[model samples]
Target chain A: MNRLMIELNGLKLEHPVMNASGILGSEPEHVDILVNAGFSGIVTKTFTKNPRNGYPPPIIVELDNGGYLNAVGLANPGINGICPVVERARRHGKPVIVSIGGSSLSEFIEVSIKAEECRATAIELNMSCPHVKGHGLDLGSDPSMVYTLVKEVVSTINTPVFVKLGLCDKIIESAGKALEAGASGVVLINTIRAMAIDVYTGKPVLSNKYGGLSGPPIKPIAIRAVYEVYREYNAPIIGVGGISSWRDVAEFILAGARAVQVGSVFMKNRRIVYEILEGLEKWIEIHGVSSIMDLVGLAHRV
Target chain B: MFKPALKTKTEQLSSTLYLAEFKLVEPVHSKPLPLQFTNIWIPGVDEIPMSIADYEEEKQVLRIIFKVVGEGTRSLRDRSGFFGVKGFLGNGFKTRGHDRILFVAGGSGIAPLPLLTRYCTIDNCIVDVVWGVKSSDMLFNIEKVALNPGSVYYATEDCSYGFCGMVPQVLQYIIEKEGVKWSTIIAVGPKPMLKSICSTIDPSIEVYVSLETMVKCGLGACGSCVLKPLPKLLCIHGPVFKCNEVNEFLESTHD
Candidate 1:
């Protein structure tokens, strides 16, 4: 029995662990590396309508808590690169989710159509990318805008739509609005807005000054975000935040994440996903559970 | 982790090239052994990747030679400058099992050659260098840094220095005239130069090139410096790679 298998709302994955968008997956070779590492799904870097060179260096800074603050500015190959990227990811026979980024509605709509036409298994609207302005946090912070954009994108394509949101004052409300607008699922927690300063240089570490923080430091917040979102509507949530171990996966599952996307941690351990899957397999075998689904929202019952 | 560097010194090596030296507030993991790199951050401007030309343990100084190409280098070329440094990051040149190693440097590509030569000399391997510059003006007394070399030869395009020709031509003459066989050739330079060397040298001789790309997280988390074909992250797999391993990288990139 493939206890780790995931099949939810028209989306199917051999395992619940996925490679989070933007950690890698910018090119076909990067995809091959992730696929070979045993991820059930491949999430490509978020794409804008045109190529962006991104911010000049000093874009990422490491924290003591095994986290990173980065303002990559949504650097991508632009929409025209969809065919080769989607085709390569599909070649591995795994589900591919192309993350879309844009400042306005047309860009999102245009990229989604191209990604969908290239046979992407699903489309992930990057409404929560923290580092890039106008493209993400600004769009996600507005609940009414979330509803409108999600609805417009949902009506434009036949592929399942997953809304990725960052942590904001009205995160739960925005997530509610997305689901209400016909989103198939939600990816909770992109990154928290943060920055660092060098005492010597006396300047902010990242060139953009403010960037999104990811990795272990945000776990507690991400867990609470996932917990609250799942409780409010019993919505299907894909958890992502500072996940590095099988125990982390178990935590997200118990908190109601149907599957989890991993980022940041890959920088430390490329094979962490396999370790997580193995650990999940062993944990479920011990719990006498038939599938990971059985453990979803177990915390809510308590 | 990038910390602020102190006592930074910038010396004009030539018209186009300059050498910057600074001491980190705290020691890095270890001296970037073999030929590792560091991402030097210029505040409010840009952070660029530089190969460690030399490091002095007594003074705790990190030395790098760079060309002033853009605003980043222009701001960094001050006599006493302040910046953040994070490294000994990325895998640098690792000498394969070769008895004799020849380093071929093209212009600013000479950045990694000094430290590489020092390490290889300690390993007691026969080492030779053929550094090609635009003219004698581009040669900046390299012997001062690359000491104890079996021999150091300079090749200038204008024929104003040691050898009167481009680096590849001098390389061919050296190989044929001396009837000497090199087990390995570590070439660092522009894409066209590295590619040309690949075509000029014998297939039996192994060629390893240090690739320069925009490296963001130096730790390999960001895909900013990803290489082609095998798709190895240059920060981790290498800033240095053998010709065969990254065949597509050479063919895909142009000068």
Candidate 2:
């Protein structure tokens, strides 16, 4: 089989498939799927210094098509709670990307440092969680803040820094700013802002009133954002948004993403990652594609 | 305590109810008590917390009754197989070790009350049960509790079947007419029913209520099942608590 290995800063992954933050919890209970599917890495759910209770009920809701609205509120067991899971993934011998978030800059630095102490392969700054009030996506929306945060994080940690970005008004410019601020790469389009109404109650389905929309609905938007950023910057792109099949993975790669992250599809079909990888390998073999790098930005040249 | 061994799905009785039994694959610390729950996980669907309704120690089998409340239970109802279940979760009712015990159950709440009655029979303790539902159609097999004789009472709000009142009302009537002196009262049901029974009774009687909180991990790791005012983990501190410990929040919210 042709190798799907790709380089992200100093880290080399066996394949492009990585679990997005928040979707996969500490145990990455779905690691079996990733391992069998030929995924290169798995990112743990976003962790903070203190344990978080997340949001109240109605945290998840289904949308049209295979899309979903989730406001899991970054409910994590804290940094202490994630250590054992990280060690387990390390024993599995695959790259473990620790997705981390914090309410303040110092908290973020502390989480990153703690993760490094546990021998995490890489750190993905989850400055793109759209559910929580003041953390995540709110932090990524401002260019100055992104720069300051990424610079501080990159300087403090010895590991490679991948800034996970959200879909905002000026994400392309923001992507450039993060790279310049010492980010090794970027994960594009966390989720678009969305909401759903309960027919019976005549109220919003989510307790938070709003959530991040993911699944096939956001794939095109994520691809476009990745293409635009790839066109303007030199940093590698980790394409994420509505990826359920091999074709969706290919679309992101052709649009210039070096790798891809799958989230919502895992909820619908735990085996979707393996299914997509199998299909990708079959297509590659038939098409005589020697490397994944050949697929990056192919659609753009044509 | 009880742990799930083998999970089996019996035929569905109605659109909302599914009857499933799990054998105690391993004996836990204590005997399975009434109103104690377990967390069940159905792959690719959802994971939910459910209550243990009956246990046959001789057969090493534990039974659970559940109503399809959300995506998790809905999926369990759809699938016909032995799904994943983790059991005897949460603190269950502790019989006061007294001679006379009264158990009040409402709606699906009746599921666990029978387990307590079964235990009382084994202990040679006197047991009286008050079971209630909104209507007769919502009722199900009561032979298990009824077979005990002179120990069970049934009530329905619509008066389509037995006594024409709620479970708490029936309990009050039983105390007045039967002249039954209950050394300890255990109530499990809707928040309103449990609250009413607690508030109307004298504190000296020793009342305990099985509270339903939104439990996730069942191991106290999730912290989703915390009861307010008490500021304690329901999955850890209790699924069963004295009325006084949770009275402030339970009474205020339910009323």
Candidate 3:
């Protein structure tokens, strides 16, 4: 059998496919689909210490290409609302990653601490949502703040801390700084800064006026960031961007992602996870590769 | 209860339309409702909510009617020639007993109205349809709907053809002139139109509105489709809701 299993901070996954945070919601109402579709792990929506209303609508806009710009403002039902989802996912016997985002260091720590009580296998610190006005990418962009945040969360939680980073300038330096401060792994490339104007109304489509872009448009940028950070730090990288198919996932793996997190694609095609896993298996068998681990960072060596 | 299923594109209806049908593959729950919706996924496109226009209980075939709205719809419409959908989601509309059912449709709102009309016709329930469009050219399959022996009214804003007025005006005229005691009013159209109809009508008369909201996951997981009052997600709670539970939503919009 082509073993697709990989290790992240001592946790073993059945496969390398994981749903990116924010894309998958707190309720696993779609878990059967995710599990049957062959995803190794599912990430819950970003949870906050308290319930947030997020931004007002039109939070999402369609770009000219098939990509999208979303400023959902991280609307979540709070940490307590996420427990049932975590329990349901655990019952399915698949790895579950709980994603938590906060405006302050204490909020982040509290949410992460709350998530530890659930059955989530790990906790992903979402210091990288670009659309929110006060939080998210702002916290991620500042290297010192990221390090301090990561160190604080990692020190408090027993579960592995995956510091999700944004694809801003000097991302490699930022990823390196995050690892130095003690992130167990890194999730590279949240949505890129973008906006869309309604030609008829002659105004921006999103309520926030500007949002973060995702999908095919960001794939190239995300792959570049993953390659740069992986080459520089050699820390486990959870590549997330525009991974819609197996080919995209393969590219991320080759670029040095230990595993890949899918967001927009899951929104577009829930079965994409299984299709990718099937395709990866087929590709591995055809190429006579013994395992997915052997393919990690193959492009970097070449 | 509802389950998510993977559906393949059996055929494309038009350049911008598709005839993709999915097998229940997995039936999360069997509901006795005439309206059902799914949170659909088109690879590399967008994820949005769509209503189940037709369903065959034995075959477990669920049909969804959608217009090419945005990136997700475009992607699904484009890739119908390639990869298809892989999720069935949301709580559908419930229709109980054979009552006088009036369907009001505008724009792509025409999709689920026809299905409801067909169901009511087969069940020998009284059915009437008021379909509106910007102009006559925007109208689709009026004959198919009119053939049911149930009254079919057409209205266009510009009055290129048919009645020159709005759907609510037509409905008001019918109720006033014919003295038709409509047991239920199910409306799916632009939010403003639905809002207008809800505001003008008496709350004692039953009215159900299929709300238009941004839906991503469609399983109530994502808060994208939440309406105020109950803070319920349209994807799971309803694409269709009784007039009272949603009066707060309509009231909030007016403010």
Candidate 4:
């Protein structure tokens, strides 16, 4: 089972499963639960320089295929608010990836420093959140800005940095810039921009009028993005989106992600993390794969 | 697959308020605890979190009351077929360990009080209710309120019903008139009413309030129902919380 351990810039994880940022990532107690639940790592919600109330409720709309369209507006406690979550993650000995979201490079730098100060294992810059104004996909869409932002945060923080990018035509280009800017890894495919409508009312469903799509509907797109990014840059990719089962984890690894983050699937049950980990381990043993690392990029070779 | 819930009946309580009953394909383990809620989803339409108005353990029938304030609830009212219902979710009231329990609710918050009253009665505690609404027409489940063993009071903002005032005002009025020293106060309503109840009630008395928030996955996975600042999950920790535990954060939260 030790052979299942994988390293991301010297941070070794017993399992390649992690909680996706912004799911149950806001609270320390919840993070503690995830840590004890068998995830090798946990990503905190995207914290900002100041607390944001986010958009008003009725934020989530469940799509047909286990997908969700949400415009939560990245509501989170400020940089100061995430310390407890980071602290709990640190105390539990689980690698904590502090996800930071800001409207500016300076805001990103400030929040990253605070996370590093809290002793987070890594920093995931949420440059690709689709629903928020003046942040998220707005910042991630420009490859040059992605390069500059990643470089500044990477330069400022001693903790390893990863850039989470949304689906865009220039996703590979964005990943390239972030890596060139000294990011330790890339978290591919934040939710894709999408919207839903209530025909009865003849109006948009979400309060913000738009949201990001996640879950199984976005899984294929996420796999494709990870495949393309890994094929071109061969960088460390943390795959996320629509991962519910052990097989999904294997697919991400085959697509070149060293590890995968599970989000929406946990909506049904948190204990599913253990189910996924157990299933992955059993599959690994039965398949006669000597090491989990051998599975990475296997699809690309054949 | 979502366990199918049959829409046994739907009643329009008012222009805004509605009562809908469903029979679950599978019965619940217990009468869903008082004020505990369920997530109701229509295949392609949307999912909305609602509180249990009543549940019959034998019949496997559950009741929910909703206000048609948004597209989701409006769409819910239009649907006739069986919907996907995920329940017996979220923490409801404890319903015991008190001598006398007083329930204060406003608008759709009145949905859960009847069940809580029933539970309190089962535990042999004195149960009283103070329900407020915008008008008399907005009131449903008057029969449920009547079923309580102790007393039931009503207040309406438009002066169309019992006491022509808000819930807290009538609650204060009842305490003064009946000379009842309540051991517990369980309040449910819009934010302002809950805040008012918090401020007006004796700080020494044990008080709990059922919260209304954007509940996504009724399980704690989605952060939608988490209160701001504290990040306490309303879906998990409670749709019910001690007034003192959440008073400060509740004060800071806008309706």
TM-scores of all candidate predictions against the true structure: 0.95, 0.59, 0.63, 0.71
Candidate 4 CA-lDDT value: 0.81
- Model 3, residue pairs in steric clash: B4-B88, B5-B88, B35-B93, B46-B72
Task: Tell me the tens digit of each residue's lDDT in model 1 across B72-159.
Answer: 8888786365677777777776554567888888999888767776777667676788889988888887776675766778889998
TM-scores for chain B, in order? 0.91, 0.86, 0.81, 0.91
Top DockQ prediction, candidate number: 1
Error of 4 at B46 (Å): 14
Best by TM-score: 1
Q: Would you list the C-alpha lDDT of every candidate in the order shown? A: 0.84, 0.74, 0.72, 0.81
What shift in Å separates residue B204 of candidate 4 from its native position after superposition? 22
lDDT of 3 at A50: 87
Screening candidate 4 with a backbone cut-off below 3 angstroms (N, C-alpha, C), the clashing residue pairs are none
Ranked by lDDT, top first: 1, 4, 2, 3
For candidate 2, the docking band is: incorrect
Ranking by TM-score: 1, 4, 3, 2
Better of 1 and 3 by lDDT: 1
Regions of candidate 3 where Cα sits further than 4 Å from its true position:
A28-33, B1-255
Q: Output the number of the lDDT-best candidate.
A: 1
Q: DockQ winner between 1 and 3, please give it.
A: 1
